[model samples]
Target: MNDERDRLEDLNIEEAVGRSTPPDLAERILAAAGKRELDDAVTPISGRHAVPRTHRPTGRRMTSPIARKNWQGAGVVTAFALLFVVGLIAFILLNDPSAPTEQDTAETQEKTDQDRNQPRQRFETPTKKREPSSPDSNEEQPTQPAPTDEPEPESEPDKPEDVVDQPEPRAPVEEPQPEPRDTVKEPEPEPEQPKEEPVKPEPEQPKGAVEQPKDDDKTEVKPEPKKVAVAYIPEDAWRKYEFGRYSVRRSASDEWNSIHGLEKEMGRIWLYEGWQLKTGTGELYFSNGALLQLDGEVEFHTHTRGLRIELIDDDLYVDNVASSSTVFVTHEGLEVEVGNGAAVIESSSGKLGIFCVDGQVSAGGKLIAAGHKASLSNRGLSSINEVTRRDWSHPLLTGARLRQLGIEDFDPAPLGGMISGKIETRTAEQLGLDDDGHVAVDNGGSASVAFRFDGDHETLRGEKVRVRYRVKGAKKLILQMFCPARNDNFGTDIVPGKEGEWNVLEIALSDLRNRETHKDAPPPGTVLSSFALALTGQDDAQIEVDWVELVREAEFEK
Candidate 1:
């Protein structure tokens, strides 16, 4: 058995020796293992098979196994990265934040349409800040706290001890809240109605009372005419003054009866022919609107045609004569036929002065025109002088002219010691004068009383000077003309024939010369600055001037 076992062991040892390869075979196994390691270092983890390295059929050498494996792995990774980028781009497009969805766009369009259809509403905003609560107990509170059973304390009267211990209450904090928005209300749609046809307006009727038309056979009514009024004078007419003193007498067959019983009668008294009417310082009006102004004493007889006035004394101013044919008999037995005009007749010292203020007068068969004065006596009419100018004719220095010369109102001033006098304004009746009414004078006693004219006397050149005056208890009256430019004076003396009676004295410029001896006299045409009058008489001497005037002699011619 031992011998057989020995033979087997020898055979195994020989086989083992056979299995132990040569060195070249060992090197070939190591090189194959190295190639696997290099492939693992470059192969991707995706488990792809690595391509085998081979040489080209030509001369080119094949690529390395590791390089081929790296190339395959790189291609696989690039494909995967491209897929990842494409997926990220698709996600961004689907989830864009600024783009609106389909549902959101529809909702925004609907909201805009609603706003356009609705009406806007307005709300007034408050301008003042809200105020905190007041401390007074009686004041109403803006907000009330939850009420309790116990009454609220009356804000305990401010105690000094409590003030230091207590802190001021803080205003409650207001949380932020959304403001209430003004809601717009949509207008309701109007209901539709059926259409109707239009109606036409009717014609209007006229108003007010209407008169019916008359037929052809009807006659029209006519209005009556009116009557006019007529004026007439009674035959038995008489008038007595409501004021003044007078007496009347009636004429009968060879007898005279006193009409004093009829003095109180307001009715007309029958004035018969040959009846006499006497008046003493009074006035009377006839029934025909005639006025008889009598001064002093006057007697008149009612004639058949008119009246025969006996101017016993004083003067008579007769106005508004009813009869143009009335005849007046003066105290000198001269008859004056007066027309429808006013006449002033004065009878003094048996001389009658008749002045016709308006209309014409006939005395002693001579016609005296209006504004003319005529002197009459028992021998009939004497001289007739025109008192006023006609039309544009040059006027003479009459009473009106003297007034124009600033002599109507006299202001008296003493001229040295040689004169002492006063001036007075007298009426025509008081001066017993006629023609252009009122007169003025200087009544005093002095050696010489100077009268200065208020205006310039240049108008007195080449004129005749006439002065009518009455002197009482004076021997002579002298008038002097003073020319201030030449410092010279001219004068003339008057010799009176009657005392206490008006007398006219005239002086011509041709006769004027310097009265003072050894003084140069002014030429004939020299203007006078002032005029003076001198009265030589005793202490009781007084004088009255009726009028002083300058006239042209040719003015008196017919």
Candidate 2:
């Protein structure tokens, strides 16, 4: 058995050697031995090559004895090698202790740098490692600070790869830093909204950009009345009869006449042509504010009394008893009063006249007659000292123009011209007189001319006619006419040309319609019932009247 074991061992050894031997081994052995032994030793096999070994080098060995050994020896060899490597590692560690520590720190810094590079990972790391203890341990490992984290104002910058592990500090600082930059960028984009507000500006049109228009103002206008003209012959003739008011047109001619007595209930009065007064005697009391107007001649006896009388282009014949008669004369708006009817005419603006056929005459106030004296009382032709007055040297009334027309006595005449029968006079009481000698044939030194005409004395009963007259010494004259048929009154006021001038006065017959007398009558009738004239005071106080003419102005429009 032993022998067999030894044999087995030898065989094993040989087998190991055979597996490990190089290709040139046999030749190298022969060269070292310096002999040719191969031919006898075994002309050994079917495969045998013989090579010369003289060129082989010496002392180059490849195989070890232990490597060629069986399993136990191989195990023992491996154990020895392990032990040697351990010893070498122990030597390195013992010599420098900081090396391992430094290595560990360097690994941690690399991880820290990676964490810093990945900001999302840094924010997520704490959630992954939720335990406070684990995070603290991770933090305790010294690491490079993250570059993404905002630097402290006092802190220096850190390197890129060395900034991975400081997750908590870097996360908060970087988060807020980006927010500030985002806030700055956010405001920069929204200021473009103001361009949309300018489209609503249409309110400037009515604020005075356009202008407006204008209109006119003067001139007196008169509205046409229902009845324009009228004519009436008083039914009863007034002799010594007193009247409240009476207006008559000369049913005989185009001339007009009107009379008013202010007494209460004096009854209807009468009128006649030429104002011829016989023994017709009665007093007219005008204590009740009656207005009277005379167109032709108004005769006053000691029996009649009156308050206000206006005359137009006519003579005012007065006796001694008809005193204290206030006569207001008007051409237009001018007015004047003659205190008493003593053969005197008072006008407000223009000429005045008195017809003194029988009674002693006196003149006062501003007299316009060339021969008439100022305040001269021409009593019974007792000529006073001749007061030679110069002719009007004014441009308005040059003597050359005055002489051309042969303007004469600015006085009233009994008749305008030569007539037929001795101007007939009649009274309301049916008293008639033939001659001028019977004018004041009574118990008193008084005379009144009164008469009445036929009702159909003219073709048209009533029609409108204007009266034209020349007023002496009238710088400005106004003539007014009053009609009692309708109780209407109208007048015209004249403007003086210059000083000391005679003015021609024209009056409209339509204006003299009597409103009260014909209240319900139609507008265009031809009755001129009463008339009044007045001369209001002006620069030229002297006045004379002549040649009363009548003209028709207008007919009432339908």
Prediction RMSDs, each to the true structure: 61.7, 61.6
Candidate 1 clash pair list? none
Question: Please, what are the lDDT tens digits per residue for candidate 2 over residues 30-76?
Answer: 33232222111222111122121212234322222323345457658
TM-score of 1: 0.25
lDDT of 1 by residue, 1-558 (tens): 998999878875644343221222333344434433333333322322222221124543333223455655776898899999989975775699876776786899898755632321111112211224222223443333348666554443322211111122333322222222212111111110001111111222234323332221012111111111010111112233332244344322222223333423223332322344554434443323234556654444544455555666776665533222354545756667665555667777878777775556778789887678888877778889876445213121121111111121231221221133455556657666442343334454554445554434553223466677777778887787777776767776677549888788777655666777534444534667566667888777777655455442212232
TM values, all candidates? 0.25, 0.17
Candidate 2 local Cα displacement, residue 266, angstroms: 39
RMSD of 2: 61.6
lDDT winner: 1
